[model samples]
Target: MDIDVNDSTPPAPEEYPDVDGEPPAWAEDRTPLGDAIPWFRKFQGGMHTKEGILYGLLISGDAGVRSYIDDEIIITRTGGSSERDAEGKLSQVADQKDDTAISRSVNNSMKFNIAVGVVIGKKNKILKRKLPHAFNVMDYFRVAYVWHERIDGFIAVRFRLEKLELEEKSWWAEKGSPAPPRTARRKWVKPIEHICGACAQTYYRIYMQGWMCLNTSCSQFWKLPDGNDPPVELDYDPKWLDWRHDPSDEVQPHYSLVPDFMSVIDDSDPNSTYSRTSWKNGIVCPSCKQCLSRRFWDGWRCDESCGFKRVLNMQTISLRAVVDDYEVAPIRRAIVFDPGPKETALIEPEIDDVYSHPYRRLVFDLPGAGTVTHFVTNREINAKPNGPNDLFIQLQQANLGLRRYPLSQAGMPYGFVVAVDSLPFSEACDPILRVMGRLTWATHEATDKQGVTALIPNELLALGYFEDMAINYHDDGEDTLGPTIASLSLGAMAHKSLRMKYKYYNGFTKGSKKLVHDDPVLEGCANRDWRLDLKQKLDNNELDWPAYEAEWWRTYKANKSGAAREAPPCIKTQLHHGDLVVMHGDGVQKYYEHQVELEKGGGAKLRYALTARHVLPAKIEPGQWPKGQFQLTKDQDYKGT
Candidate 1:
């Protein structure tokens, strides 16, 4: 799997691709191949290692240490900071530190004869030539030598890498030309080796000026002969820079530089199991051979417009079988009722009342926040045809145009984005209408006792999760949203948990970076006695909020580092098919965030979370408003059953 130069270019566009479609902005500059292929992926540092084994080297000319490529050899420096003195200034080169993890990995690779892939950054000045790509993937090489060197008054590790294949022509050279033969180039001589009398360490005379005891532990380290002062800076000896290693038997790489992308999954076999972890990795486009990240929900599409796309055809599974598989699990024998250290309790009906009604209700009242209510439905509610099972299958086959969107400027887009009314408001199909109706009923039931009016949901977000897919902790407290939000769980069983906001638990301001107050006397948070004392002071009006905040900072600074600790979940429960979870009150989202994790190793391969929210019409833009009238007919309304 050598990447040919032509493979990077996209194919020519069709004569009339699309009347309204603009040409795709194919990326010309090279970018990090992040999990696009198995062999090579993006890494942070100059060296890439896995489990203490060096796998690749990123050579850049802009590093602090000198690095260069000459013929078939690469001379690069290791990574680490110099030792600082008591005054915080860097120490002499002899006192520099070279014991970094990357340096150790380089030494390990040299000792183990591990072949490492080489990538050349465009900014490299060693070759004094511009590269065709920002990051050019070179062939693999073996760590030929490892040594310690002094650079800018600091000790640094250096590696000498030699190309594994000696007979192949170097890609950087002129077309059809191999490296200049040793006999054809200028004559070169090897540098003299010096033995240190003080430390008994062998040293190479690589400096242009002279040689000294290179060992840092020796008294004569960096000392020139006859007390001759060493140059303020050092330069490599031209003869040493020109030195080359003798040709050896060709060594093969353990893996190809570009792994086969088509083998990621058997696309032809629709019945095969597809784990989220396996399919989440990017794929190499078969047409342009460019590495593409898995950005879209449906499939991989080449951004270069090479006319290559792969959409996975996942089959709809039975929700009944999924519930059956979950019940068989060992952990399902007893329901999880973790009250956490703060004693936030989980309340449920007695055994007699549990199965009496159309649905069983469970509730957890969060401290200083609103309630989280779960309506556990009966088996009749989850039956086939117009039930959760039918809804799950229909949603899977619907053309909702669901996809993932980037939450921030960097990193991969995570979690499926909201799929709003894709059709006219008056024309929404049964599946969407069913979820909205159920959520509406649940929201009203959960909030009516509190004298809070329920808001009819205008938007529904249908998110699909494969094996191990999950939604991280986030709040639904948006200005445009109503106080209550409800969701319907379908397919595989999922575990949902709610936790106090970090700022609320730690009493620290997230944006201002200040210790503003003591903990809010929550049940599960740390420092209970301190929080209680503060609460008492506030109750008595002996201290106001500002005064208490100042006192808290003073007291906390004396014993703490002002670091925030993660708050544990106060409410946790499992959500099965036909389960309705209603989070009522603005305080719930304001004080807490929730997350949902799908059950792994299940009978159903997919789970769908259809959440409905009341989107205020005043907040929507004029152009974004729905075209048709929005109204739910009598038949679309759902009762408690």
Candidate 2:
């Protein structure tokens, strides 16, 4: 359960914001909330636990946040195994009846920071009376509200470097000139005509336009345009479309947990809360200096990564182990780290600020360092022993390198504890493991314009096959999203529902037809409750979307700006190993209202293709924004949408 610092009083249903069970019809047009972006920017070593937040707002002029003496948070660095004061100066320690306290680090360096920035541990439920950061530091207490976790624990850096960056006043956004449009596309040459000498029998103009047989029966009857012998173009419009191609075998489900987000409900607090936000989101415009975005949990964020990223921490609740007797892996880690790159100037977004803009911006803009601290607490229910080791086994079972792991590493080398923000590979991950392979190989090597190698000879055949079956429909518009298109399974597979998606924007109002409450928006559509609403956001144009839903996107403005608050989606999930499921693109319930029904006990972890046709403009730098990754929010400084 989550505890909201804004409201001191613990809330019940009466105090809770009235959450509706349904959304409007036009909600379909809203973009699916940008998927979460993992946090791996930090160069965090091993550590757990976070202190209170100390915030200082950025005012005008030459004035700035003071150092530890003045405007700074004034944290006292007191370190020790059992010492609680700044400098770890405690002399004596008390014994506990049971294991009341965690095993403190014995190494002098492992001692906790003695200086006191602000103590925001769960012990004291708030970043209150502290430096006054934008967000409620206490929010990290509940598992529901923590950031993504790494397997053993979270990957976090020390506070010293983080403090250094804070004092540097380097908190700024980035800017860039848009790239020239990709023009000069290939001219779609037309097909040619061929005439027989005597019988005048026609034959396909294969020599001129290749064998695009318009009519199978008249294979040799090649049609002509006006008087042009070999037309550069041929009939391909919907009006003149024909032909069929066989598709490959259906790809199975590759489920993935919307990282950093374990569940909707916050079980820590009595409120039984739900965190609507996640880490697997997109890259925003030149925001933080660090181009921090990653997969899997890395220890620390890049130096330039934002400081006040809300890190949610929690352990997975194994359904199989209802009682404490069963072992439960309290943690399965996945982090979103910062990757330093675009830290020059402020580049504001060009779209409207929706949902809660000012608050989100402040929360996002807070200049500090990012960290991922993770630990486990055994809260045995009914006084039972939850299998810790066994629980850990379940957690790592589906990881990429699960097979190459050690259960009890008494003296084994720690596996590569990579920060997802860094490149994702064992020395070879960064460049080789890219969504788009090298644009070009070495000088001696060969590749296509797009950097494709000749080794994949089967690619041509696969493309032709997919295109053919894509349009080849025989059933009576059967109204089902069957013949599932290609699905790319990364690892943990799960979410495969026959749904469709149609995004809308700024289309929410009391009685708008698109806002119709809780009814099916489209004919034959099932599970239409996932519809989203962006009535608050201003439209963004930095990245010209290849396509849009309903073409109804309108200019918008920030209703307000304060603290960023994300309401978790009811459908977000984490995938398990060896799981496979299938869903079609047409009925995907992309934008419009949609419902998701689990197949009894068969509901496995959730999955997303991460294969949305999101294309970046040319201006995006290769070194900065990794391939297959983009931002959901507008940049840092733009004024209008």
Candidate 3:
């Protein structure tokens, strides 16, 4: 066994020892792959032995054989057909793009190397892969050294694997896995290229891999290729493989809806108004007013936006709504009117009004619109008509005709937008806009004191209900929506209930106190900020502090009671015909979910609701209303005749 040895090889560095030598402390435990490295080395050593040298595994002599995956490896192709000899046999070359793509893909997958080593074990059974073919390692070859003057000269190895037979009874076929077969009988094979033999015309393989001829009159399974068609070429590109491969053994990173830049603290400053479990008061940039924390940036400037910087020892303030307020309401069977600004104020409910009257109703007299009854009769004599009666009628008719929103598409509450057919400020909608503005001005309850007006109703939703129809529980907590939501019920009475979400329900339960831990735990050195390390850890998917903190609080709260419980306290209310219901703060939406059930005392009668909201400016659809028109149309008189 006199095998040639490269005696000129450089010594392995002491700083970086092999797995067998004194391993680094970081490699405390040997992984399966690490354990396999010695076996690979042993195999390489054996290949150099006299008996082992017969398999052309070394580059020392002319015995080393390198096979190209592609027939045209040295030359690039220009859309040439698969070349063949006069024997009409398929060429033994792969498409260059495909060959390169597969090579890159195989190299990138660490599993491929591990799988090769694993299958080379004592059993030597073929291993199954999600790719088009299962495979088994048949041979191993490694070059010990190259005649080059490089430090720490390395060894490179290659494995020769043979594709295994596809099992017809395997779960892969039963599950309809996308892995294509390698070969097919001639009778079942069909041309994958554009032209269809039956149609003698170009056709797409869009419907299926074995697509039938696309002549509607002649479309039949008989015209389709047999299941024995040549195997579809496997695309080994990472992007391509990602679509076809099943991620049966991958660790997905955890994701939090909280902004990447945001982190939660266990405690708050004595003077700070950041309420327990509330985003009420937080450090915010003076310019754009986005949340500012130690994790994302220095001081108060959001690096991505307006570079507004400010020094803050520890100050917390509320951010203002970025969009204007708006709303709409339907009157009982008679008519729906946008009770202009003055009238809206007269009909507006007080801050804690729902507390006193579980179903309180109000009546007010507008200077020009006359006396109006809330939660009772819908009234309007003859003031400035809200808009052309014809327009309102058209909107109602359209509402009836529009299809019910599908549950699958219900990202938000399933509802329909009012036919603002005119500009958001047109005569038909201007009165509604003014009404919304008045409601906004009337809402004095400041969830956070940095800004006064929290409820802005700029978007109007005309929601319809069929007999026995009920709205599933959900919260309007989208970043785009304002703190307050106002609803005007019409036609029939409906029972509305607000319930705390399961995660936060305990907070509202009897004697359940909020979990508080406001300590300066995230320590930083004088020279280096530990917060930066936290951010890096978060970005690298190493830590999820926000989710961890939230879960910690939940567990703490649950354990405090010393009893296992699931639900928390819930608040319920009812919206009668012509009733006005207003949600005062964003807290309710963030902490709870609400549902509306149709009260069925009056048989199957239609119930309509006019819901209003202030959507963030960026969320408002472009062209729904011209820019700068919200305020402009407020003071403008309706010219609709």
Cα error, candidate 2, residue 338 (Å): 44
| Clash pairs, model 3 backbone | 189-229, 266-517, 267-518, 325-456, 325-457, 325-458, 326-457, 326-458, 375-578
Measured with C-alpha atoms, the lDDT of residue 305 in candidate 1 is 50
Predicted structure 3, TM vs. truth: 0.30
Among residues 3 or more apart in sequence or in different chains, the pairs in candidate 1 whose N, CA or C atoms overlap within 3 Å are: 93-153, 342-523, 342-524
Taking the tens digit of each residue's C-alpha lDDT, what string does model 3 give over 1-641? Answer: 23233567443322221111111111111221121122221222112112212121111111111211210011011111234447543232322232243233323332332221111221111121121111111222211111110011211122232112221222212133344443342123222435656557664342233444444333332243762422322122222111211223341211111122224333244122122112211243434433333221112334564675543232222111100112122332232333235311213322322422322333322222122223322222111243222222333333122223321111122223222222243333443453344334323222222254554455555555544667878877777676666665654457775544544433223355443222111111111133334345555677576754465455545546444243322334445444455565555576556788876543333455656666656665565434213553444332211
Candidate with the larger TM-score of 1 and 2: 1
Worst 10 residues of 1 by lDDT: 406-415
Give the winner by lDDT: 1 or 3: 1
**Candidate 2's residue-wise lDDT over 230-303, tens digit each?**
34222222111111111121211111212233244243531121111222232221223122232212111323
Which 10 consecutive positions of candidate 3 have the poorest summed lDDT?
A: 70-79
**C-alpha root-mean-square deviation, each candidate:** 8.7, 37.7, 27.7
Question: What is each predicted model's overall lDDT from 0 to 1?
Answer: 0.64, 0.21, 0.33
